[model samples]
Target: MEILEIENLAKHYEKFDLKDVSFKIRPGKIVGFIGRNGAGKTTTLKCMYNLVSPTGGKILYGGEEALKIEKRFKQEVGILFGESNYYPSQTVKNLTAVTKMFYDDWSEDLYRHYLQDFGIDENKQIKALSTGMRVKYGLALALSRGAKILLLDEPTSGLDPVSRDELLDIFIDLVGDKEHAIFFSTHVISDLEKCADDIVYIKNGEIIVNEDVTDFEASYLPRPPRQIRRYPSKRQAH
Candidate 1:
């Protein structure tokens, strides 16, 4: 079954208009949302969670309107708009305390595990982290919420090659469970080659290509990986 469906999503700005944007994200897949800058990728991501209201169309999760089940949708579907650094002066520990208050399913064990795994120093303020660390920290918060689907926008933006590779590994590991999935936007096609299973290419606010990465590369994207590594179907039926 498809995990999420975006039907005829459209949004309008004075200068830019997103038209007929549509896609489906299936469980057990990494769907890479690819586009050039100012192609409405971030705007489309925001519309999914109602951060920005869509001009038309539906965001459906489990066959129900996502906004109708707003609280549950927010809880079960994690979204990170780029690397988050909302309160630059806030210590990681203090910020985490406040964040935990919002999620009923927040798992302390998982949170601690990610902190250790990412080597984030909780005592340090947000501004102290390097670009890579900040991204990892945002990931830790998103992953610890136990969300089955993660929506990430430009997650690999400022990382060095090594850091980007490590982040890609984490994305693969997270979606190893068939019940979990990721939909991330990136202009960095090389990163998608390493992990993504499907490609959703948007151009000028419209979906131009939606297919397996291999085909996408053969038909369009020039930089294809040596191979794609997909780790899916590692879970029991619910």
Candidate 2:
């Protein structure tokens, strides 16, 4: 069964309109949500998470309307917009202590494993950790809360190359279980090329393409110029 499906999703504003955006997120696959900045990527995500009301369309989780089961849907879905910069003064442990209270499935063991694996110090203040570590910490919280689907917006937007690569590696490992799915939105095509299985491309508030990553790349990759065979000029040919 599909974990999440967005059908004919639409959102409108005075200046920008998102129209007919549709896609599905399945288990164990990373679907790269690709679009340029201001191409409605964040707006679409906001609508899905109920941060913004969609002018049209519906979202489904496991074949049920999300609005009908909003609480359960929210619990199963983890959304991280950039990183955990919300409580810069608080220690990781303290922030997590509060975050865990919202989820019934929160697992301390899983949280500790992710903290160690990501080299995050729970005692460190949120501001003391680097940007990359902050994102990792967010992931730890989400996974420990038993999120089956993660919708991350620009998760690696401002990281250094090494940090970006490390995050991508973590994404790959997270899906290895074939039970988790990631719908990652970004303007960074190279990041998708590294870890995305499929892509849902958007432009000007509309979906442009939805296909396997390889197919998307092959369709857009620059092709070599055609060779032109030229016979000798007519006057000299004879």
Candidate 3:
């Protein structure tokens, strides 16, 4: 069964317009939102969460309209943007404390497990964390709230290779239970190619490709990894 569906989704701005955007995210699957810059990827995701109002279209979560199921739907959805807007002075523990109040199903045990698993220091201020650590912290917060559907926008865009791989490993682990589904947007096609079950490509505010990853890869010419540098492991960096 489809967990989320976007039907004829469209959003309009003064200069740019996103039209006829449609897709489905099924249970136990990873759907990669792929597109070039200015392709409406961010806009589409914002609309899903009602952060940005859609001029036209309907979003359905489990066959019910999103607007109608706002309360229940919000609990099921967890969002992590490309760059989290965190107070630089706040520590990891402080951040989690503030966020946990919003979710009824918040799990402190799960949150601590992720903190330790990710090697994050709870006492360290947000400003002290590396780019990778910030993103990892964001994921921990989202997952601990018992989010069944994750909406990540460029979560791995600026991380090191080791961090990217680590995040991917966590994503793989999340889907292992067959209860979680993720829809993440990224310019990093190779990363998506590595793990995404399906790809939804958008261009000029229109969805041009929405299909299985294998089919999409088969039709397009392959490109090698962008960088060949050997990145130091987290242990080595520390």
Candidate 4:
């Protein structure tokens, strides 16, 4: 089933306008939103969450007009930004104390489990956490709330290769349940190439490519030289 849809969406500003953007995200799939730095990747994501009001078009979540968004919808959707949103002085334990009140389904046990699994210390202050740890903390909180849809903004940016791979593994495991959907924006194409089922390429405030990962890669991206040489010509030594 489709969990989210963006149809003819538009967001206007004096400096830039995101026009004619559209896409759908289904359960058990990971959709990668990709673009250059100035593209409307973040803006489109914000529109989905109602952080930015769209100038035109419709956003539907579970077949309901999302512009008339509801609180239940908020509970179903989890958001993670590129940077930490929590106060630097707060410990993970203390931050959980504040965040837990927002979700009726919040589970302390699961939250703590994620903390352990992600190698995050509950007692450490948010300021002391590394970029990857902070992202993990955010993700832990989101999962604790029983979110079905994850909207992540540049989630792997600024991380070392190992950390990026670790997060990608977690993302792959998340959709294993077959009821969750992940839509994340990133300039890091390699990360998407590894885990994304579909890729949405945006350029200068518009969507340029929205297609299955295998098709796009096979049709658009060329094979590396090493792989190309694997198929030897008959003239060459076997």
Candidate 5:
């Protein structure tokens, strides 16, 4: 069954527009949303999470209109953006404390586990942490929520190769239960190639392709060599 469905989704701004975007993410699948900068990938993810309103189209989560769903529905959705906007004065522990009030499923043990696994200092203030550390904390919070669907936007963008690989492994572990699904957006093709089961490519606010990664690679090949004109052989010309 489809875990998330975006139908004819569109969002408009003064200078940009997300035009007629549509796609489906099935349960237990990791789907990669690939696009260059300003390709509406973030906009689409925001719409799915109800962070921004869509000008047109509908987003359904497990048969319920996502926009109309109750707060409880949101409890099952976890989102991580490229940059975190947490309060700089707060430490990771403090942030987790505050988040616990909002999410009944929040697990303190798991939160601490992730902090250690990601090599993040729980007592350090957000402002003191590096950008990659902030991203790690954001992911920790998301995973601790016990959510079934993870919506990540460029989650590993600024990290080094080791950090990126570690984050990728964390995601893999998150979905090991086979009950969760992940929809992640990124420009790093190699990262997607490593973890994605399906891929959706967006260009200029439109979906260029959506298919299984293997299928895309199989169908995607270098263009054939073109015929080249050569000077007629001297013998043939004679």
Candidate 6:
């Protein structure tokens, strides 16, 4: 079943537009939104997360219109953007305290575990952290919120190769339950190859391809035609 569905979604701006984009993310699957920079990937993601109002079309979460959902229901959705959104003066512990009040199911243990795993210093101010460390902290908070749907925008863009791989593995582990789904947008094709079950390719404010990666790969493989022998000739003669 689909955890999220976007149909005929359109978002317009002065310079660019996301035109008639449509796709679905199934439960337990990682759907990669792939495109080059300025290709409308972020616009689509923003529409999905309700951060930007769309000019047209419908967005459904688990069969209900997303716009009509209750705040409690919307709270189950988590978004990690390309840049850190935390306050510069606040430490990780301080931020988590504020987040816990907003997320009904926030788990401090899980947050702490992720902080340790990601090598984030909980006591350091957000401004003092490196770009990659800030990204890691943002991810740790997003995942620890007990969100069923994660909307991640260019999450691995600034990380080193090893950190990127580790983050990908963490995503894989998070989806092992089959109750969660992730809609992640990234220009990094290699990261998509590692974690994406389905791919949605966008270009010039339009969706070009929405397909299962395995199926697309299979279609690219060579196939041989079967040959007919004497039996076919005999039938023709009869």
lDDT for each candidate structure: 0.91, 0.90, 0.89, 0.86, 0.85, 0.86
Clashes of each: 0, 0, 0, 0, 0, 0
Question: What would the TM-scores of all predictions be?
Answer: 0.90, 0.88, 0.90, 0.89, 0.89, 0.88
Q: Which parts of model 2 are misplaced by more than 4 Å?
A: 222-238
After superposition, which runs of candidate 4 have C-alpha atoms over 4 Å from their true positions? 223-238
Better of 1 and 4 by TM-score: 1
Model 4 score (lDDT): 0.86
Per-residue lDDT tens digits for candidate 6, residues 181-218, read 88899877778779989988899999988999877556
Q: Report the lDDT tens digits of candidate 2 across residue range 1-238.
A: 9889999999989999999999999999999998888999999999999999999999999999988899999999989898778789999989999989999989999999888878898899999998878877887887788888999998887677887888788789889899999999987888998999999999999999999999998997456887999889989987
lDDT of 1 by residue, 1-238 (tens): 7779999999989999999888999998999999999988999999998899999999999999999998999898999977778798999999999998999889899989989988999999999998778888998999898898999999988777887888899889988988899999998878889999999999999999999999988887675576866666658432
Per-residue C-alpha lDDT of model 3 across residues 71-176, encoded as one tens digit per residue? 8899998888965549989987888788898899899999999899889899999999987788888888988999899999998977889878888878888887
**What is the C-alpha lDDT profile of model 4 across 1-238, one tens digit per residue?**
5788899999999999999999999999999998888899889988888999999988889999876766877888888887675799988888889889999888889887888888888899999998778877787887778888889998887677897898888789888888998999988778888999999989999999999998888876666656444766788956
Which of the two candidates, 1 or 5, achieves a greater lDDT against the reference? 1
Give the worst 10-residue stretch by lDDT in candidate 6.
Answer: 216-225
Reference-based TM-score, model 1: 0.90
Give model 3's TM-score versus the native structure.
0.90
Question: Which of 2 and 4 is ahead in lDDT?
Answer: 2
Question: How well does candidate 6 score on lDDT at residue 139?
Answer: 89
Off by over 4 Å in 3: 223-238
Q: What TM-score would candidate 4 get against the native?
A: 0.89
